[model samples]
Target: MELDTPVLDDHMHLDPDHGRGIDAVEDFAHLGGTHLLVVNKPSWHLGVEAGDPDAVDPAAAGEEFREVFERTIKVVEAASDVLDGRAWPVLGVHPGLISRLVDERGFSPEDARDVMQAGIEVAAEYVADGEALALKSGRPHYEVSEAVWDASNEVMRRAFECGAEIGCAVQLHAEASEDMSEVAEWAEEAGLPAERVVKHYASGRLAGPIPSVMSEKERLRVAAESGEPFLMETDFVDDPDRPGAVLGPKTVPRRVRWLLEEGYEDAVRRAHVETPQSVYGIDTEATLSE
Candidate 1:
């Protein structure tokens, strides 16, 4: 284990060829990858990846999520031997996927599009302006943003409530400080703690070869000072299909070093180890340096 210079690839999607087996995780861990947060799509959380494996559109509408949790349990258990208290799992629904689930489950007011055309019968009742819109007919956004946020909060709350519920760390995809601030706002409003939440999708504007403005970078500085436990992801993907993965092994270390140079050691350490180890149930006491 690379305990001395550990890096946590906090968020990883399952690539059919590159990410399916425990061996890959073991090797990554042996190569200084101390922590990995395996991400799985759940039906209830629909903003990023769909979690339901059986839903009509598993990637969109989302299906039963408990099964995904079950699958996660198995994956974590299977990887336990190789990880030996190093690897961990963080579980939560993506924003898009969760929105879809919230709408379908009658937990939040549906968009007009969610209503079925006339004469169409569908499961789940839709309540709009105190009126029940059958699965077919169109309705309006009697939606209170608060209501929707609360509903999502409840869903995540249940995920956290279960003792087995993996924090896997909470994340959002936003770039600017305003947008990223909104991510924190939503997380708090949804009952997610600031400490366990991580901002992994600081993609697009927040990172790239060309630098984003220093002002925009200040969001991270503020987040660091808020005394809230938040982390950042370099968002590196190691799939064979990715050019960077094929080109260089420099992305991970470079980003960590950059964060260090920025005087964001809190963010750096959290992104690399603390947040992930805490969230994914990994043994943090062990050094992860190779």
Candidate 2:
């Protein structure tokens, strides 16, 4: 299906183990996707292989994230070469890593904050240098202790501050909750605009001033009721081991087609074209023209 307006996937992952690389990107484009916000997954220093997050050198962990951030820029460049500037990187430290540092890696809250701030600094450099478009941080609700949860929130607050300093939008990865007013409040306090904040992998039921990357499973009625300035995503993990883990790469394009068929062309245009442009500062026309 071809869309008159480009369809954007607000959040996705691409790595050797997760996103399956360029071929998967091609698949997404062939299915009518025009833009993507690709995120960098946490580093091995954060314990991707080990079930346990034993204590590691904080400097070593920071180095691991540096390497990953460099690789993430390369991935974005490669995807842009393939997709003709349709792909952009959203760089930051994952909040789950903060929990690991505090809970399993034996990091003092101060030390963990230092490491997280370091990661955010790297992300800010990328954004300031125009290599990345946005920053991301999240609180993983599951599999974290209460202390870790609270610590993650603090880390995320620092992330918001980083985004404010660097003038980059922040995409948050957290579960859908009835009350997200605190999120807006925090963003405001940090000097970040609520309109620039994104709730990644959000449900249609979510309501607030902050924008959301709605899943394909979102109800159309709920989407309509939620108001304007929303985006769509598949959150494709690209893990061969967990095929279709979150959703397929083609999910957003297909969803756009479905929405168009349902005669919601204006809504599709707003979500796919206008919202992304306003939120991420993407030039959709230039991206697709390339």
**Candidate 1, which ten residues in sequence have the lowest lDDT sum?**
117-126
Best by TM-score: 2
List model 2 lDDT by residue over 1-290, tens digit each.
Answer: 56777878888888854548778788888887778888887665323322223445443444446677778788877777766447889988877676666666677665676677667777778899998899988678577666667767877887788888988899888766745778868988999887788888766655543456555545544674556678887778766768858888887888888888777787787787788778777778777878
**Looking at candidate 1, what is the lDDT of residue 241?**
47
- List CA RMSD, all candidates: 11.5, 3.0
**lDDT per prediction?**
0.38, 0.74
Off by over 4 Å in 2: 17-19, 45-63
Model 2: residue 78 alpha-carbon error in angstroms = 1.4
Q: Candidate 1, residues 72-101: lDDT per residue as tens digits?
A: 445655554555344444443443433454
Judged by lDDT against the true structure, how good is candidate 1? 0.38
Clashes of each: 24, 1
Error of 2 at 90 (Å): 0.3
Question: Model 1 TM-score?
Answer: 0.49
Give the clashing pairs for model 2: 18-238
